[model samples]
Each structure stands twice: as structure tokens, then as C-alpha cells.
Target: MNQYSTHDTSGAQLKLWDSAGPFETGAMQQLRNVASLPFVFRHVAGMPDVHWGKGATVGSVIATKAAIVPAAVGVDIGCGMMAVRTSLTADQLPDSLSAIRAEIERAVPKGMESSQTANHVKGGWAITPNSVGRAWNDRFEARWRAILARHPKVDGKTSDQLGSMGGGNHFIEVCLDEEDRLWVMLHSGSRGTGNRIGTYFIDAAKEAIAKERLDFHLADKDLAFLSEGSQLFDDYIEAMHFAQDYAVANRELMMGRVLEALRKHLPAFKTDKQAINCHHNYATRERHFGEQVWVTRKGAVSARAGELGIIPGSMGTGSFIVEGLGNEQSFCSCSHGAGRVMSRGEAKRRITLEQHAEAMKGIEARVDEGVLDESPAAYKDIGAVMDAQQDLVVIRHRLRQIINIKG
Candidate 1:
């Protein structure tokens, strides 16, 4: 752990878990900015994967008293990871995994734009499945209607995107643990709806600050916030909770579809019944240091003692299933992944197609220029990241992906 004192009158400090490696100067500046906020409680805790983000540094845990920063949660309201252990073993899988990958892609819509034909949408469901429809109608329909009544700008395309995968770092994979046990893992979140809600609230926060002429001046305009007891604050809390629920349901729907697709090609397999579903990007009220505050984990996961979390590496690298130790100093949080070491644009310009293919040599995934930005070389070494946060979590299972499907 490393500490940096801003020497500001706010009396807040910056605590970082990157002693095993170095982080960008921009990320350190963001941390300092957050720590300097008057409402920030105690200090700002940064995970080993900390990196520069729009508002706060990614992999940061911010606990604030009577205030909330909408942009700190980012545009992906409930983005996270989910993993399920299956009964299938390595020997059960066929020598080739191309067929399985193809099936998964066919079952779930991926990439920026859903493929479409004259008659119907190709990537998404041409006809909504009964299960998905039932889930939406029973669980989300009413809440969505209520939200739309207030904010019509929220995307109405929720139904079609329920089980579809979005592009950019979101992925589904088939992996094997040390025991050769098979597990299916995926990364995604509330799709367009979450984006719309987050954008609306962020802008609303800025407007509220400006309209009231609040005495707050943020280091980054995106850090504009909503104070407690305000009507906009209540509205944002409601909408944010709804988006989070949608994200959980979205992952569940996709998991079911992926399992069904796998069944079509492989022998019958049963899941362990309990899957770890967690959100690394989101905010919730919690009692920290004997005070009720909003804990916003941006690119960080709740690591309350005995809790299960997933920390994935870039494609072609190993991932881990971890158990949290509930370290209080960190506000019980851990890194989301081997955080990006390079910007997407820099990665594209510096990494070559040949290098990407070589890095992902054995994995069955996209080997083209489209996926070059997410290559393993673009991120920090997972081993170093894990080493840096030994106090936060304990590894339970290490997984190596054999098949990776990137959106």
C-alpha cells in the first residue's frame, strides 16, 4: 500500500494498492481530486487496477456522506461479471471448440449493431423467447413504464436487448480450472437503458448544481453531484436501482441462453446451482465507519468477508474466483480486472494483428483487427495485480479460457 497526502484542509488522504506496479499519473491526479472533496469520508481507497477514468479513477472505492457522484458510477450503471461452474470436465469437451463458439454467438446478439435482414433482426431475437418475455413482463414492465413516464429519453429498446450481449470488452467464455472442471463466465450489464439513465442523471446533476449556484467547484465537471434530500437525488436513486435490477436480469437471461446453446453440442451437464453474480460498477448505501454513506464502486467489487467475486484478465490470460477478506481500510473492495494499461486508441495504434493472434494462440476467438484493442498486451499483468491486493481477497479457483466470444 502507498499513501499520498494532498495536504488539503479537507483532511482526506489517498490510499493506493499498486505497490507491486506503477499506475498512470492521470489516475493519481484523479484520486487526489476525489480525496480533496469535502464530503469524502475518511479517504479514497484505490485498488491495484486503478486507472484514469472520466470522473473518478477506475478501481476506486469512494464513500461519501450525504452526497452522490453520478459520474463516478459511470454510464454502465450495473456493469459486472457472472460465473457458473458446470459438471462437465475437460475430457467432456470435443477436441475442437469452434462449434460451441459459433452456437453461443448465434444464440446471443453481439457487436455494436445487431445484424438485420429485410424481414427481421438477425443478431437479436426475431421472435422474443417465452422465458425472456415472461421475465420482462413480470419483473420489469411496470418499473419501466413508471420510469418512462418521468423520463421519456430512456431507451425503449429494453425488451429486444434483454438477452443480447453488447460490444467492447463484454464477453462470454468457456474455461477450465486446475481440476479440469468446466465453467462458463460472462461480462456485461444493463444495455441501452442503463446508459440513458446514467446520462440523464449526470446532466441533471450538473444542471442542479448550476441552477442552485452551489458553492462546490469540481476538479472535473463530470464529478458534479446531487445532495441528499433533493428530489433529483431521490429520482436518481430509484432509476439507478431499477437499472441495476435490469442488469442482473440481463445476465441471468443470457446465462440461460448460453447454457442451452452449449447443451445442443455437448453432453448433458449440470451447474453447481450457485453462481457468483456481482456488480463492479454501481453504488449503494452502506454503513461504513459507523456512518450511513453511499459507497460507489467504480471498476471495483464489494469484498465483504466471505463474499465471492470474479476478477478476469484480458482474453488469452487466466482469471480468478476469489473470496474476500473484508479488509476495512479498503472499504471492503477489490480490483475489477487486470486494468487497462493503454487507451483503446493507443492499443490499436501500437499493437499489431500478428501480436494479438500470437498472444491468444490457443484460444478460440476473434483474431482480427477488430479485437486488437482488447489483446492481452493492452492490460497489466494479472499476477502482479493479484500480488498487490493480497489483503483484499483470497483466490479459490484459477481459470484458463479455451473459448472466448468477444462482442
Candidate 2:
């Protein structure tokens, strides 16, 4: 086991797995702030990719008793990665991947830019596909109606954005593993509807705190939480679970579309049905340290023993398929990715398009100024991150992208 550094805070010790690399002070402060919360369990665990986030540190795992913080889970509920290995080898891919990339972009609506007419939004489905509608009605319709009946504000929003990818860090990629095996990976979450559910609850939590006159002082207002046994808490959990399911379905739909696109471009191929679908941003009820608690992995993946998970790298670097060792100190969690070393705005201002293009050399991805913020230099080294989390997970497959698409 790698030696972990510990810092004593007001309520619990902050366990950090970042001694092998630089630790940001802002993230440290956020971790301490979270640790100071009254209901925080044992201690807050900081992953190697820890960075400062809105209410809590992005890569920190917070296990709490009797309460749940909405913002700590963040607005992008159930945001995660899904990757599937295909029967086709790297050699089977066509020489030019431009057409395949374009087909995927067409099949999945990406980015925030939307075209609107008298009564339609072009960014989402004009007419919901039969498959998408069936999936929603079968899996979500009844539960969604219940949630809407309670929270009327989120009622008007439909599932039109169910299969669409949203802007910012969400992406799709075609990659080759070390054995030259092909895979398709994507990152996304429950779309507009999830955002509505999350925001509504966050505000509701804050209002409850004010109304009940809770005497706790929070470092950030976004840390407002709904206590266990409260009506709002039950409602949030139901809605959150629904959004999580939506996110998984969203990825599955996009994967099906991408596979169809690939079939049009390449020879016959089949995907391994045991593909991975894991969430990095979400909370769940679990047992730990002899008690039940809510474990919120804000920007971390659950690494329960022998569990499979995806740890993606930056646009140009290599990603990994990993197996968990279930280190208890980390609450059995691992870093989501090579966490951003710089903010997007900072990267855009500091990194030139020439440097961005150079960093992405050999990868078939957008190298324009618009994508400068997502360049490899904008993120921490993936190799170093894996090294720091040596006890949390074991690398299974090393994947380098041949083609990348970003929203």
C-alpha cells in the first residue's frame, strides 16, 4: 500500500492519496470544509485527481450519516463513462475515420448550439424514435409521473433530450487497446431533465435549511442538504435514481447508434455484451464502518473489490480499463480521470492553438482553437494519477484513442 498523508480537520481526518503529485491548496480547503460538516462520516477521502469543485472537492468521496448534500453530487447527476470492446481489430478499421466520426456526430446531438423553429428544438429529437420512446415509457414513465406530480416545476421538460449528449467534457471516442482490439467509449449524463431535478432539489434543500433554522455554518451555500427522513430527502432520492437510470439508458442509446454507424463503415463486427457502465458523479446508500450511510462520489468511481471501471485520460493521452482492489481508506473509490489541472478559461488563455494541435498529434480529433481548453496539457498526467492510486485499482487494458469527438 502506498503511504497516505493525513490532515486533521474539525470533524474528521482528511485522508489524501496525492503524496506522489502536487496537491492544490483550493482543493485542500474544500476537503477541509466538507470534513467540518456535522454529518460527515469517518473522514473524507481525496483521490489522486482531486480538484476544487463548486461545493466540494471534485475527486473527494464523502460518506455521511443522516443527511445528503445535493451540490456535492453536483448538477450532472449520473454522469459517467461507458465503453464496449468490439470483435473487430484495429487493422479492420478504414484508413479514413472522418466519415465514421461524422456519422456519430449526426446520430447524437452534441454541444449547446441548438436551432429552433416555430415549435421544435433541433438539438433534441424532432420526433422521438420508437426505441427511445419505448425505453422511457417502459423504464421511466410511471416513476417520472410520480416525481412530476410532487415537483410540478420539472413537469414541462420531456425526455426529448434523453439520447442526446450535452456540452462540456462529455465526449465519444474510438480507441485501440494494447492488443489492438477496438472499443467505443462515451461520457454523458441525464440531459436537461436531470439538470432541472438537480437544481430544484438544491434550492429546496437551502430553503429547508433556512426554514428549519439549522444552526450549522456551511462554507458554501451549495452544500445545503436535505436530512434523512425528510419528505424532500425521499423525493430527491427517487428523482436521483430515476436520473441515474436515464443516464445509463442515454449511453446505451448512443452506443447503439454509434455501433450502427460503425457497421455502415466497417466489416461485420460484434460487441462484447459485458460492456462497462459506471457512474462517477452520484450518491448511493451503503454500509461502511459498521453503519449505513450515504456515500456520494462526486467525481470518483466506486472501486469495490474486483469491480470493473473506466478511467479516461485527456483528449490525447491513453485511457484505462481498471479492476478495483477496494482500498477502504478511499471508501473503495478511485479517480474519475486525469482531473483538470487548469480551468477551461485558463487553458484557453494560456494554451495556444499551435500547442493544442501539437499535443493532439496522431489522434483524429478536432485541433481547432475552439478545442484548445480540452488539450492534453490542460489535464494532469494520467500515468501519474494511476501511480498515485496504486492501492485503489489495477489497470486492465490500456486504451489510446484513434478518433475523438467532443460536445
Candidate 3:
């Protein structure tokens, strides 16, 4: 028996793992638009967390033959989660976590646009640390320059954004697992550089559609795609990969800094070197069914059997560490998070600041109106989302954040 329900449109069948929740109309339409794309290999899969996004629906897995959709990969290339389980337990935590949170915030610069001043250098680092500089120079500099040589428009500000957390859903948290072990978790991406590459290619795709004599016509311009074997396709693939690798290094650098900072307050402990670091909003070629196709997981995780991944909830809610089941029909993918039920604007307009504070009662997090959009109420029921994709993964650890830092 099939594990998924079909949300059939005209072209490719869209399989939905929405057992616990129904599809919203806007999200359904976005899926339909992707399904109708001619190059879609076999099927499109939607996770329980599926929601309307700028190009494609979040939580979608699109496998296409000889084509790639830049918008589907999204602007924040390689955006995902990283988690490290530590030897220390929750009982070791200080009574006042405020100081620890402050240290972490200081260690990792966050939020939008840094003034580059001494007092408050938010967003990018005020001064690029030697470690970050080495990592960039060793791993990224040459490839970045190569990409810029071809598509300089894709170039944007500050490699200092490396190892720093950016604003929005991006955050850093100190969590305690069910067994009460301390864990460090964070969510971020390739930052501004990745956004620039994605935005440039998304437009390039649309231009290819308009300029080239392609037989296909897109109902939605965002659905525009670059055909395989073209110069634009090759360039995008190269640049996109650079962004993805940069993002991984970005997370690694931040994790090291966060761990180093934590040592000041807590007893020294070693981390599980194989910390869970995986990307959600990225694409790669993989074999599905019998076809080797480009599978783009916009808001999904590659859940190949035995692979561990992190699925986090909203602030003050529960999160899970999971092992993939490698369910083939869904392309061995799972939902990235609880997924937003409301847009940031809608959440702020509707969810009261008082309610937000009440919901975050036991947790140390920003309950101000500025972070109101990220309140727990703004997201889908995480438990329900987990239940919906039971076949996709097995839960390893259930974690609750005691200290949370938002960008």
C-alpha cells in the first residue's frame, strides 16, 4: 500500500505526506504549478510542513529530468540545521542562563546589516577572526573568485557574514534532550552570498525563458527553469555548489565559536564530532525509482536510511533528532521543521505579545514584538508533523530549548 495520498493535478502526480494536516489552497496551487512543469521526472513530494513560499511551496521535493528550477532551491541556499550533543547534562546549567546567552550572542554576530562599528557589530563580524579567515581563504576564496569571474553580479558584500547568524528564522539555542544531556543547535544558511547567487540565477532562468525559443511556457514566472547542458545551467550548478559548501563551512565555523564560548560558563566537554549538519534548501542529482534526476528539496531534508538529521520546532517548542527511513517515494526526504502556519506579518498582526510571552514561560528567549512572528503559535503543531511522516524517519532525541538566541 502507498504511504502517501495523491494531490493530483494535470501533469505529474503530487504525493503529500499530510496525514495529520490538510493542504492550504495557496500551497496546493504552488505544488500544482511545479507538478505541471514538463521536465518533472516522476512525482513531486510535499512534506507535512508544506506551505506557500516565494517560488515553490516550502517542504517540497521536486525531481526534474534535464532541468533545474533556481527559485525552487530558494534564495537562502544551503539553509538548514546543525546540532551537537555534549557530555554535560542540563543539571549543570547555571541558574541564570542570561549570561550564557549573552556570551553566545557576542561570539556569533547576528541580525540584519552590521554597522561595522566597535560597539555593536551585528550581522557580520566586526573583525574577521583568524580562524574564519583561514577557512574562507583555504576552502572558499579560490572557488568564489572563479564564480565571480563568470557572474560578478552574483557577488555581494562581506565574507565577514561567514560564521555569523543572520536574522529571521535563523537562531542559536542551548537545548536539553529527553535524557537531559546538553545540546547546541542552530539554524542559518549561506547568508548574503548565497542569496545573491540564487536571486541572480532565478532571474537568469526567467530570462532564458523569455529570450530562448524554448517550447515550454510557464504559467508562473517563478516556475521558470534552466535546462540541463546549457551554459546558464552549468554556471548555476557551479555557483550553487559553492554556496552550499560555503554554508556548511559557515555552520561549522559558528558551531566551533559557540562551543568555545560555552566553555567559559560550563565545564569543559567534548562534542560528538559527527554533529548533525545537513542542508534543506538545496538541490542535487540522485537516483529515484530508476531515473537519475535533479532533486530539489526546497524545505526538506535528505533522509536516506541511517542518515541522521535535525527537525526543529519554533521557539519554546520541542525538537527532534531523527534517523531517516529512506522512503523512496518521497525521495528519502523529510520536513525541515514544524513549518510556519502563518507569515511573519500575519503572526505579528494576530499573535499577541502577551500570549507569546506566556507560551515561552519556562524558556529563555526574546518575547518582544520584534520576535513575535517566531513565537510558537506561528508554526504548525510539531508533534502532528512528526506523526504525519512516521515512515520517513525514526526519532532519536526529543529536545526542548532552555536558552534560545534569535538573530
Provide the TM-score for each candidate, comma-separated: 0.95, 0.96, 0.97
Per-residue accuracy of model 2 over 1-407 as CA lDDT, tens digit each: 66467855444578888834557878888898889898999999999889889888999899999999998988889999999999989889878889988888777777664544311255577677788889989989999999989998977455787777777888999999999999999999987878888889999998988777666787778889999998999999999999989999999998888888889889999899798999999999888877898999989999999999999989899799999997888889999999989999999999998898888888888988888889899999899889988899999999999999988
At residue 195, candidate 3 shows an lDDT of 93
Q: Against the true structure, whose TM-score is highest?
A: 3
TM-score of 1: 0.95
Error of 3 at 250 (Å): 0.5
Candidate 3 RMSD to the correct structure: 1.5
Residue 370 shift from truth in candidate 1, angstroms: 0.2
lDDT of 3 by residue, 173-282 (tens): 99999899999999999999999999999999998888877666686899888988999999999999999998899999999999998999998898886899999999
Clashes of each: 0, 0, 0
Residue 363, candidate 1: how far off, in angstroms?
0.7
- Model 1 scores a C-alpha lDDT of 0.87
Number of clashes in model 1? 0
* Candidate number with greatest lDDT: 3
What's the C-alpha lDDT at position 376 in model 1? 98
